[model samples]
Target: MTDETSARIAPPLTDLPIAVSERGFYSGFSKHVTIPSKIIISLLIVWAIAFPVNAGEVLGIANTTIIRLFSGWYVWLVGGFLVLSIILAALPASGKLRLGRAGDVPEFSRFSWFAMMFGAGLGIGMLTYSTGEPLSHLQNNPVIIAGEATALTENAVRSAYVYSFLHWGFSAWAIYALVGLAIGYVAYRRGLPLTIRSGLAPLLGHRLSGMSGHAVDIVAVVATILGISVTLGLGVEQFVQGLNRIGMGDWLLAKDNSASIPAIVLALMIIVGASTLSALSGVGKGIKWLSNLNLVLSFILFAAFLIAGSALFSLEIFARGLLDYVTALPALSFITNAPDGTTIGDGIAQWQLDWTVFYWAWWIAFAPFVGMFIARVSKGRTVREYILGVVIAPALMCFVWLSLVGGTAVELVLSGAGEGNIVGTVLSDQLYATIAALMDSGLAYAFSVLVVLLLLTYVITSADSAILVVNTINAGGNDSDHGRRHIMFWGVAIALVVGSLLLVGGLDAIRTAMIIGALPFSFVSALLAVAVVKAIWRDTIRLRHGIECTVPPEAKADPAS
Candidate 1:
């Protein structure tokens, strides 16, 4: 556990040359950019362009079909395995394992670390789903529908929050945790490249340098771009809704219009521009500052709602809903359908496909980008600490936020205190309209301003980190290649993907693309879980055996060997 051994634990750094002479617009092709990644990125650009131009034939049928076909049990197993991985890692034997060298101190403070992980892990998801998802489940949940409950009863409310937690809670974060742990341990402990391929070194060994490694990085880049773009698109949609809610839609768009091309362009330009600058500023300065600002803005918004809205009612729902979520975890985790008696509509199959299945796909798609970012900032922490920060803390915060925001909306609708149909409004305008309905004029205006600020910061945090993660993967895991031009390229790429898809099929097209992208990476995630466990086992053996460390011949191979 000395510095020498810790240093030895890091795999020898490989020299993957970047072709400087091949420069073009936005840090052109590098020699280090593997062929598989290059080809995948090229085809993706063409496909995205075609999706918009031939939306009728290309996106309407093909992409939707791909989403429907693969977004079933494939994603469910992905979710289940991820949750199991995180739970296992937190156990006594493995939980003590450090992400980096033994006794290494974390680079960022507890506050900064938590803030960054929370911002990167959830991004605009909280902004979009905090209100809409909870309300949607309350109204249309399979459990309630099967029982023939037309009204929002006490039981319906409990089930609604439980489902919301299921989507955003432990299962979602587990995907990120598994990836982060794998990459972090390999990069910090085993001295491997901090890329997706490196996460599999224990499992794949020297094959990591062959086509196998290239394929893994390619998948990571593709999934990161598509996954982050889906979030960017949703953030833009919600930002537009907030603008409209605050009476600024006319200024940003035409009269009574939402999701117009001009508005979408404006939002993307702002997001990509800010994110590029943040990426250039590096993780310590730009990402750190924005993350802190985002956390503060979030607190302001949450507190405003809690005070202005019914505090007691929201608190009661959150307290009770949290317990309900915990109590229902075992059944809910495995609940794919209703029992035989409920001769209801489609029962659990359809419900699983729509909500849980789609969410699993989205989280899987996001795992690489968020997981890498989490790994980058989490050096020197125990596996247990990482799990608590990455999984438990944020999930609980989401539950509370959902309770206060979406819970209040449901209460308002059920009590007939709100004007428009809350459920219908949630589907369209999401949190903005919900905030508008829940608060008075002054509070509503304040909430709207906070929403815009929070949205901007969260998207920037996501975009900047995604840009860095993509660059790291493309550069074969050398994070020091912080060329401004490279960061700008990825930043613009994210904007284009989201902007074009937003124009074509709107959010649905973007969602479909994300699910399709996640399908392949879901298998990659399963491999990573296996890799992490294997790596931990070897590390434990090494710790016990000291200088004459013992591992299998394959596990002991040096990079040059």
Candidate 2:
């Protein structure tokens, strides 16, 4: 086909606002917005008063029941769709699928970049699951998959890695990749505002520039806040629990339910201040620096776990678990907990439902923000580079972390060589229990403390970035710099919501809250199917036909009608 013919096949820009706002845009779609310091700090106070959320009851009976309805078949379909997309993304010829400014190479070193990306994206999960999660799974693997009432002796280690990898692998990455692709293409090529709604521009056309689009932006903003704040709350709780474990069980400052309103307020202050400062420093220096620190500390934790914990068992578990993960990946990727699901016990099926469904919900809920963040950071990069870096690189790093930390825990417990009950007490104190049980060295304890601190850094990194993303959705294109004062407002808002839920119920409460919050958004994700396909079809046609046309002047930013 002639260039004109080829271009004609591409779709026109959807509802992109004209002349992308350059002053505030970071990476690609993220913008620098401000939330106030006092407002930010006050979240801890609300959380302190909340003093333990009643998450299970708070989400109510019906919402919990709704989340439970997500069937294995649903995951099966989602996983399959995700795999198909990856295959397309991985094809050798995918190099031709350029987005904007053809041949935009990565500016940062590969190692530093990938490490930061992985650290920010997966930090909370890694820390949360490292100690207790493995041991619990080891004691009893997923009964449904094993065809038994309890875990198979050999399957415990394998299943943990299996589930970990499944959660972090292709499906999660696809959400990021597609969303990033949408935003990057629109913002970089079409020069739209760096907002989540911009990704939908190609589909919505000029209409997205109007009040109709405002609704979409609002939903995206709320979802982004809820998703990231929940994760941050979890991180703060982990920190408190870790401190307790380390024998520094002071005034319950770190404890969620146990913590006073003052304590919760303190934690919120710390997270928001760090987040606001980081936001000021700009994405490249602030986020990149903290992310680098996070990566280094994560590596240190892995090394400590490998060398000081149970070297032989860790290595053995790493190798064997990897093999089993590969073997069972397909089956485990889509396994569900609906009855006929398994014949375990009374609460067993419920546990499985809560666990698996909750994970899917979390990943799905955060997908939009994470995807938007990845796209923003990935400007001047190619499709191949983006896919490989965003998907492949992170998955491997997650596998390594699981193998080292949780894997070693399994080896210790199964071999009858360590205090197996230590993992059981993680809810009370994760950091100290991990350090005390794994190694007897002062150096090891020091290292563990450092890792804990580093974990804190990452929580800041992710939370701050999340705050920015959420604000971008809120302010729309009319404003990118709603100023630091404006941004801090949401940061504090997040802290209150998360802290209150935690005090009312803890992880269980958050889990229930997240599921409830996530239910409506699941339908939104389904809408993505129609949106992306329409976008692709239209954009592909415009590209093939080589149409270079001007979007209407004022309508460009308010094109929804």
TM-score result, candidate 1: 0.89
lDDT per prediction? 0.76, 0.61
By summed lDDT, the worst window of 10 consecutive residues in model 2 runs over 28-37
Residue-level lDDT of model 1, residues 1-561, one tens digit each, is 687665545433222222322455424333445445546655666676765566535655765565557654655665576567666666787788777765478999999998999898785888888878877887778677667555465567877887898888887788888888888877776566678878887777777776677778778888988899888988887787777777874655444345778888888998899999999988999999999999999998888778777678778888887888788877666655533555465565567777887888889899999999999999889888887888888888888888888877878777777665566553537676667777778877878888888998999999999999888887777777586777877787788788877766678878877877888888898889888887776666556546322222124445421
- Identify the leading candidate in terms of TM-score: 1
| Predicted candidate 2 versus true structure: per-residue lDDT over 427-473, tens digit per residue | 43554566666676677568657766976887888887777666556
In model 2, which regions exceed 4 Å deviation?
1-11, 18-58, 72-77, 92-95, 144-155, 245-247, 253-262, 335-337, 345-352, 477-482, 533-561
Candidate 2 TM-score to native: 0.83
Deviation of model 1 at 409, angstroms: 1.4
TM-scores, all models, native as reference: 0.89, 0.83
Error of 2 at 438 (Å): 2.2
